[model samples]
Target: MNDLERQSRILGVLTERPFASVRDLQIQVGVSGATIRRDIEKLHEAGRARKVYGGVAALDGLPPRAAALPFFENRDIAVAQKRDIARAAAAIVRDGSLIIVHGGSTCFQFGCEIAHRNVRVFTNSLPLAGYLGEHGTCQLTVGGGDLHREPGILYDTSGAGHTFYAAQFFVGALGISAEGLLEQHPLLVRFTAEMGRLANEIVVLVDSRKFTARPPTVTLPLSRIGRLITDSDLSDEHARMLEDEGVDYIIAPRGGEA
Candidate 1:
């Protein structure tokens, strides 16, 4: 297999287990020891895995590590659930209010739901901003920053210089464990955090699949979330966790009411 594909497999393995060595990874992926070492290096560089003595292990850092895959590929994994979550989140918006949206497939879907509304949108998501401009009457202010091609986000030093504000911020979680929300890139966190600061309320759109998974990094604490919208298939245990954290949440039925 190609290097990226092999590395994705390695990450899958590492995530399932714990730590592994170079020999362990080589055996699992059926690659040469040297090839395994190269893969480990690439994973470390991407902040997706950490190099251990023998091989490498998944790096589950605080939310917002550098994601190895591009957003398009990663986003397709749980699209239907995301769309459901987006529709529910969209139902909570009040017309004429200001909102901030981060960059991700789910957030893009959320943007789509609000496109025809008369609210204002401030964002660092390049793709979402572009989509909103096409169909939304909302005043769109694209956040200034370094554009990341993989995630289609404008980030870094862009929000630090601007003192813009919002009424609510809409974001999607890459993963959510008992620890909190996680994302794959530092830039994503940078912009998301800034958006959080600008908004009075924070709404997170996440599917049930993300409940147990741990992305490479963390984005925000569960306590910071004001509301969560998900699909009806989410587990009761996961729902309890949200309740325990005092996060108001709802799971809308597929193509049904929120």
Candidate 2:
């Protein structure tokens, strides 16, 4: 298997359990010990895993049930930009449309923008799901999986118990570049790809700041993104990059202007 695929498998194992021995990863990933070691080293460097004596462990060894403090920590960063982008994205959701909303602070803002809309939403965000369940009029379906609190995403590596499709998938990125939408966590990389497969089009919701933040792993290529929505702060150079990639984009106006 390739590096991305093998690393994803290793992370899957780590997510299902707390730690995975080098031998276990070798057997599961079907790679050599040296390959597993290298993968673990990379994961460790990316802050997604911790290297132990004989195995690697998920970051902090925290269970999936803990409260997602990180989500709240990020909820307030770039608040105005996220709200503007959310409003723009909300406009794209027609009444009675079905859409998949992936987990992230930015996506949570998008969820809030559509909380009372007459649409159907399938989401993996605990925060979004909770907000929608309490305040939304739209029909909602949540993914069945372990809730990873650090990233605030619910995902099942097995892809079990999920059988829905949507016209569009709305997601966020840790970083964006010529390589594609980047994420630091391997599970997120895998789950986002799975969600993309279930949608006819992919809509990216990212703040302009992410363009310069270079996360290490690419989740989707530029070709896969059908449209991108960002705040007005996006630079001309980055906008040209999207245009060159044939990606349709919208720059949301600030301060509630139309």
Candidate 3:
């Protein structure tokens, strides 16, 4: 990785947990110890982190500590359910469509489902980008920004080379209530907002678990959503509420083909 890529990974690593040694960062980032130290100094200068005994520490009020678990760790939960959701979300894409894919475990699975199609995917997730690169035939456009490595998500959309527009936006949220879509990662929220602006269709790829998984912040209001693709397990009460709000949604069956 180059210096910028290495520094981005350092920020990502520290976001999940504190780093006590330069060696730890070297192991996670696979760069020289000297490079790691220089990266730490860069982070310190940027106000993203601070130098301490042995290694770097996440700055206060940065939301790194409050961010959700790493994306791979999240993929282990509700595997079949997530796959079902992904397939349902993928089915909506037409051949040659340009789609914006939001970050999160479920959306990554959605990318897996659409990878072989003759479409293009614009995204801010490095993990999603890498997944598409390895398994997808679809054209991939990864936005430039700091890499949140654990989740492989890119943030700070200002780094993008040009503005983008999409036919569809396949997105996932941390929580959903009458209030709106919720998220723990502030940067991810900003990225999502940008995606929402660039796409005509904002399709939310949330599973049944999110009905009660409320986070402290609202990323997008329910009114802006075009549709919801969720598992069959979504409860009747919440489904009814969606109707009251006029938010269209689709339920992917538990054991059926995606």
Candidate 4:
């Protein structure tokens, strides 16, 4: 099998079982020990699974993810990189365009940058919605429902269909991988999936660090993503992998870029 096929099988094992040792993966994938080790490295680098001793572990370990850095506090985690990504993302917003935006600090930066545009934005982020409402030249609509405290996002868990539609969805990821985007919360998976249905295209905005780790659950898949705007620090290996998958990997200029 090809690398993609082998990697896909490894991911399936990681998903079904908590951990997969190299020997076990070798037996299951019908590959050699060296091949399994290389597959593990590829999975780890792609943010699908993490390496632990002689095996790969699912992102399901660790705490329940009931906690997250507060919204204001998260603003400084990677401020410049987020800004660069936002700037690149904002360029795609044309006048009178309609788009959907999800919640996160990176996405918040995107909201802040695009406040002067003529597009109408539909969002689930409380801060972003409020910012657009107060200062954005564009029209702003907030998704109404329960408020999630950690990130202060509004999601309708009622399982009701969304009423709005947009040409694009600008979303951020806590974790990203070749297989898909990941997030700790199941609520976010449902929300993003629902939001994705309303848009003709999905644009993911995440920094380079997010690529090193996978979150507990898959929120969206790589196939659904039209474009990914990230910082310049993303590795060439990942860039090539994304190219192979047909994802438009946009490298936003960071402070040190040429």
Worst 10 residues of 4 by lDDT: 61-70
Q: How accurate is candidate 4 locally (lDDT)?
A: 0.82
Off by over 4 Å in 2: 1-69
lDDT of 2 by residue, 35-122 (tens): 9899999988988887753457677533322121256656756788999999999988889889999988899999999989889999
**Candidate 4: segments with Cα more than 4 A from true spot:** 1-68, 255-258
What are the per-model numbers of colliding residue pairs? 12, 0, 0, 0
Residue 16 of model 1 has an lDDT of 66
TM-score to true structure, per model: 0.71, 0.72, 0.72, 0.72
Cα lDDT tens digits, model 3, 1-258, are: 788898888888876674435767777888888888888898899887878534676776533232365776566556788888888877788998999888888998898998899998898878888888887888999887778787668776465534767899888988888988988877877777777888888999998767766678888899999999899888998899889988999998776563
Q: Pairs clashing in candidate 3?
A: none
Evaluation by TM-score, superior candidate among 1 and 3: 3
lDDT of 1 at 58: 67
Residue 26 lDDT, candidate 2, scale 0-100: 73
RMSD of each: 9.0, 13.3, 11.4, 12.7
lDDT of 4 by residue, 92-117 (tens): 87789889988999999999998998
RMSD value for candidate 3:
11.4
lDDT (tens digit, per residue) of candidate 1 on 1-102 = 999899888988876665565655666799898998898898888888877434565666643332344565445545677778888888899999988888
Indicate whether candidate 1 or candidate 4 has the larger lDDT: 4
